[model samples]
Target: MVSKAVVSTISLILVVGVALAVVAFVHHKNGTKSAGENLSPSMKAMIDICGMTDHQEICQKSLSPVAEKGSMDPKEFIKAAIQSTINELSKSMNFTDNLVKNVSSSARLIKMGLDDCKELLQFAVEDLQSSFSMVDDNDLRNMNDTEKDADLKNWLSAVISFQENCRDEFQDAPEYQSLMTKNLQDASLHTDNALAIVCNLGDILKYFGLEFNIKPSGGRRLLSEDGYPSWLSASDIKVLALQDNGRIRPNVVVAKDGSGQFKSIAAALATYPKNHRGRYVIYVKAGIYDEYIIVQRDQKHVFIYGDGARKTIVTGNKNYRNHKTQESASFSVLGNRFMAKSMGFRNTAGPEGHQAVALRVQSDRAIFYNCRMDGYQDTLYVQAYRQFFRNCVISGTVDFIFGDSATVIQNSLIIVRKPMDGQFNTVTAQGRARKNETRGLVIHNCRIVPEQELSPLRFKIQTYLGRPWKEYARTVIMETTLGDFINPAGYHVWNETSFALETCSYLEYANRGPGANTNRRVRWKGVRVINRREALKYTANYFIHAYYWLKGTGVPYLPTFR
Candidate 1:
């Protein structure tokens, strides 16, 4: 009864409905895309940005909502990456906090570890905020700065270190360790992704039509002919001049004999000026003061000196027997731009008191010139930031000179002390945990010798240049003299697993000594005998970007190899 046109229309409608149903079935079957379907522009862009990271899936997932906004700005991508890290870190911190709250007081070690994890997570958040601030403040679309890039990477690297250190506190609690690891996995992955993006920031900027200028090693010198950093302030120059002429005036003095304004170093530090500018000088007279000293975080631009390294001593005996390693420091400096000269920091806990720290330096751009750090184990904790040790003496037995800071020890003496019997010695344990971290120990033009007690026992007790302390541990020994006491193998593995051997970076360049021979060195993938060009990369100028801050301290350093 119906017309032919009506019948044709029904047929067309049915065919169209079938095609739509098939497309819907295919889309549901393949979560990403249907067969022969092209990806959305924003999704493609997200893949491209996250392709540089180790965790592409996490990166893409974290950035999916941001990508939906359809903005391709690299800065936006970086900001999102940092935000994702902050989110994950916050979650982990909450998880740790709950664990700490629920932990029983009877489980002292576990409780202590949880408390440490909570504190470390707080630090991680602070570091992430710092990184985010840098990205948020700068308009990367038009800026061609490298220092900012380096600073961002450094902060992110510290975040990773803090997370790892939190996990390390649980070495005695395996169940807690596994739980913490699971909790921190996403945070760690997010951090790694953020760091990778920062490491490749220049390339990313270039892709977005901006050139990130990374100055070459051969660029203009940072120092002027007057042997000062070009960026040194006029007031800093006057202070250094006065120091050189032996007419320097100190803001405060500490004398054990009650001759100065303060009788003790701790008392002197208590009077630090709030929101002060320029250098706050403290002179400690020649005497031994048995007290723990901490230069608190707000005390900036502090310069403390003593009569001489041997004459003035700050001594303590706290060790692993009773206190946490972090709390066992004779002197801990948390202030930025701190400088110490001609002073000795000691932990007289003896070898029996393992993991006693002589000096713990967390100050940024800190300088130790002609100072001595003495202890049996874990002597100098170069905990963080850029530190310079020039003409200094550091003595220890096991993992003595260990930390995660970007450190350079030039024209110094590294003494290997006799350890407790059945225990060997390791001079340095650079704790660089991630590949993108700008942290390492660069021993340049130094002498590594055995202490008076260890000299004879050197034959029986083995000593190594260093060992891999973390997955990406990095240490460079260049133009240094190593004693015959050092093991010919040059380095040691962290464990039988040797997991770090394939990831760490150990380089020896132009080192001359009986133990410096690379012929008998461990055949690790990361160990290398570098050439001159490679050696230049580890020098003061390039390694820590010392030009920006070192010269300002008035500490004599080799900007390049002599």
Candidate 2:
């Protein structure tokens, strides 16, 4: 795919030459050279408004033949051109403006920046389509005769110049590279339309024996509707709790000997199908159960909704001193399209070694809405693809919500129970496959508050938002309220050494609170401080597709963008 600049350059050279020839012919036919072509004040004003006055002299000279002799309505042609240019430019600006209005300092601004950049290109493509639609269809087929030759040349020159300016803006602007990346990879259909119109103008002039030679428009729409490299729509949502019937009946009720029916819950789970339609919902009764639960691989599209987070506790004591990392998990979900609502998943493992896991989810298209995860060190492992947690409470110490997945935690409360010395709250070890896997973590619109505040001498309580294990352990906070317990330096590297800084991509944006001091923020070489335009690209439309699919679930609060 050629850059828009290169195409503009080629088109410019072709159109400029044609304009000069038209001027020569007009002068020859009139048998005298007047002071430039007699351009209407309207045409001049249109040129001035579009910032194309620098080419006013060229337009006047080129339009001489058409002014003297042409059947086409020059005013109509110019109006079409002016309207096209304005529409395109306005659309591009709108996309960028919306991005800056939505993120906070604790938000992950870098990933947001990249996504905004992609959207900008999309707008540009849409603009191009509008530009193409403005070109008169009849003009494309008609050949310019002796009288219309100058008009043909002038119109072609102006259209080419308009396109050239678009090329110039994108090429010279440093930010344009990031924003234009995907479109450049494969120009979208709309962009192709604009390119086609620009190229066709030359052919229209050529039919009149003009000197212009426009290149072919070789654009193709890059993104596909089918779920491919990009996620198009939220598919596979699981609902565990239905509105009226088939609500998940977990068997943890009071039984014959003071012991609840923990085993019965497993038996009830056995009745669930290997894979159900759309989303899966499992409704659990309120109880204090000492049960270790597992949703096996075959139970696809399974969702578990409980009475309430505190009231419905799925707990087991798998402390570091007693169990291995694999065997220590209190609840493990290994099915696809799994979701849980209003449930509490806890592992009472002391903050010594990697022992407890409140919930381990290794499912694609999984979510935990209005739930709670409680533990110390590795509480909730967001262990797989496209996972989300909304309006949930996660309380822990030392890298509690850590994992290697493309997960999103939005509008949730992160409670640091015991702020450790030099320990950070979240450590995202995103195992983004080297140069391949586009995986990371996103924390948006969340609140970070601690149980108690400590003194500075007790070791700065260094609560970094994240540490990047892969080059892209991406984390962000948008519109989040942070308490004074949050450390000023928002992130920390693996070691004091700077080696990891080169690969890690930790960052924040627009956060507020006494703890959100920008002056003391960690100055990592890999991390970046981003603006709002960059953050909005990873919008709810892109991230939480399942929410749109399963919006009716009685989950009280979910992140929504109008």
Relative to the true structure, how large is the alpha-carbon lDDT of every model?
0.85, 0.53
What TM-score does model 1 achieve against the real structure? 0.89
lDDT of 2 by residue, 1-562 (tens): 4786896686578467445543543565647874445644433333332222233333333333333354244334343443444444455545445544543545443334434343334433443343344444334433222113222332222222222223222332356445544323222222222222333444434333454333345322223343121212243311222332444444234232335443344655776754444444445677766788888766776666677999888887785544434346788886766778788989876566554778887665677888999887778877544577888998776667765555778888987765445555643444332222224567677888765543342235556566664444566666677777666677766545554566666656676677556687777765676677776644454443433333444443344432
Off by over 4 Å in 2: 1-264, 274-281, 319-326, 353-355, 419-435, 453-460, 497-499, 544-562
Q: How many residue pairs clash in each candidate?
A: 0, 27
**Model 1: per-residue lDDT, tens digit, 225-275?**
777667666767778878877787999999999999998999999988788
TM-score for each of the candidates: 0.89, 0.53
**Stretches of candidate 1 exceeding 4 Å from the true structure:** 1-40, 106-111, 141-145, 213-238
Best by the TM-score measure: 1
